[model samples]
Target: MSTVIELAPGVRAGFTGRDGGVSREPYATLNLGGHVGDDPEAVAENRRRAARGFGLDPRDVVWMNQVHGADAVTVTGSGPAGDVDAVVTTVPGLALAVLVADCLPVLVADAEAGVVGAAHSGRPGMAAGVVASLVAEMERHGARPERCAALLGPVVCGRCYEVPEELQEEVARSVPEARCTTDAGTPGVDIRAGVTAQLKRLGVTNVTHDARCTRESTDLFSYRRDATTGRFAGYIWKA
Candidate 1:
């Protein structure tokens, strides 16, 4: 299932949970990523179900290769957008989808400009400035940072995101807000905090996030918790 919100009068955005699909076993249900070893037919059917849930045709949804890099691209149509972490579009009725298990799925929309963008930011992608890349693409399409609203959600939270101190320091060197100490006193990285800080610094103050931690929530998928699990997605479009 999905929980949706209107970013603006005509723009819609939502994140999906790990339910309502035909995948079996570890994937269980609602596994949308095609390259994740789930049955290809199951992945395709799940994607179609997700698109239809948003009243979109399966062929009209735009997806990405998602290498967890700092690259973002602009797309005018559906299908695989590119080997990028984010996809931005000004085309109405074109939905941008980002798949993530523990990583952050960030959705951006500038209702006034009719532009929407989606990014998949893991700790690496977050430190690498993928969100910045997304905002930059949105700006290129007549969207002003201050006029954009962003949604971050269903991620692996700070408490469960323990990391090596050196790696944590590495990420902190770039996005200080990501540095965290877990309840157990180990270094951790909070992707949401880091992303929110990045967005605010870039003049995007309108932000909303889900407090649910994928690792902690059974309703969502978590790679850290289940090594070979399914991936849910966040989608944005103008309807």
Candidate 2:
């Protein structure tokens, strides 16, 4: 079953629950991103299906060329940026969409303030402070830090997502609390844990996690889980 986490009554967000649309083999079905070697037509149709599922205007959903950096753009209009890792908007009906494979697609909203934001938190971007950057921009739009709630969408959980020692060291240096190792001697970084601690430090009101491990679950698209795979999206919009 597809799951959508409700941070508050008016805020709605979820990962693209698999098992629908048209794609093949590596992509299988319900692959929403076009850049992953899927058929363009199939990708377009998949996106259309997602729009219909979310009850959103397909054209109004904003996207960005993710560079895995800490650049968050504030959307005062429709259209996207060239090198943005996150998007925040106070405008209604404009859904902020982030395409992710194993990376965390973070959704944030201030229901009462009519503000919503989405961030692409891969290794580099999370290390560079993408989520924090987005939260800062959301505050600029009149969303109080203590009133905005965040949802860490489906991603590669620490257990299934392993990393090299150097990379783990880098994560620890960038954000000290990012390391989460298991008793079996598997060393890795937990993006959710790191980001959650950062959010708390920023005074974010509420932060809830979807708890779906993309790499471990075949239901969600994961590049790490399936070497070459489709991108399932996690998006949010102000209504």
Candidate 3:
């Protein structure tokens, strides 16, 4: 059930599920993230397999230690993973990857600019202006927001992601059109909608979203559904 979305002609990205990795239960198969307390060997093997799906070498992926911040780093040659929320690059054969469970995985590409980006968009980061920062960072590398196309991958829906009243107020204060509460009078936060609105505000050309919810789908790993479960990845690159 890991669905892949092709945004532009030569740029492709997808969210992987737990069906293809080598981990056992708890971390159960196909877990691609290494910092999730899964076995190192098993995680490494899983990453290798997932990398191959993009016709890329496993070592070519530049992973990041996401801190739910607004910083987006640019990678040139393969080195080490940095502490950031997003990554953009024009380098060929290097995949910009983001690991997520309930957090939104955002795939972006400017086909004409030969630029591709991947971002882990959670409430804190999105509220802190991660999407806008990402667009700006890409622009620094010659990618224009009006020419950018975005794909929002699987994430927890608002109905399942209830929050506190103060948190909702804070999100609303920061993001326009953010769903601060549900119809049942429960406080909630919709990270996906916040990101969508932000993209629209930035004048992004296309924004695509999938209906799948990681917490609701048994095919994908869910952090909130199962606290100790493994992590899945969303990746994109230019070929």
Candidate 2 differs from the real structure by a C-alpha RMSD in angstroms, to one decimal, of 1.6
- The reply for model 1, stretches above 4 Å from the true place, is none
TM-scores of the candidates are: 0.98, 0.94, 0.95
User: Looking at model 1, which ten-residue stretch has the lowest summed lDDT?
Assistant: 1-10
Error of 1 at 10 (Å): 0.9
lDDT of 1 at 116: 92
* Ranking according to lDDT, highest score first: 1, 3, 2
Residue lDDT tens for model 2, 1-239: 25545666677676686668889978979888778899999988888888778877888888888989998888877676558998988777788888998898889898888889999998888899998899888888888879888988888888776888888998989887789774456888888888888888889949888888888888888888778988889878765
- Number of the top lDDT candidate: 1
Count backbone clashes in candidate 3.
1
Model 1, 65-144: lDDT tens digits are 98989999999988898899999998889999999999999999999998899999999999999999999999998999
Query: Candidate 3 regions off by >4 Å?
Result: 1-4
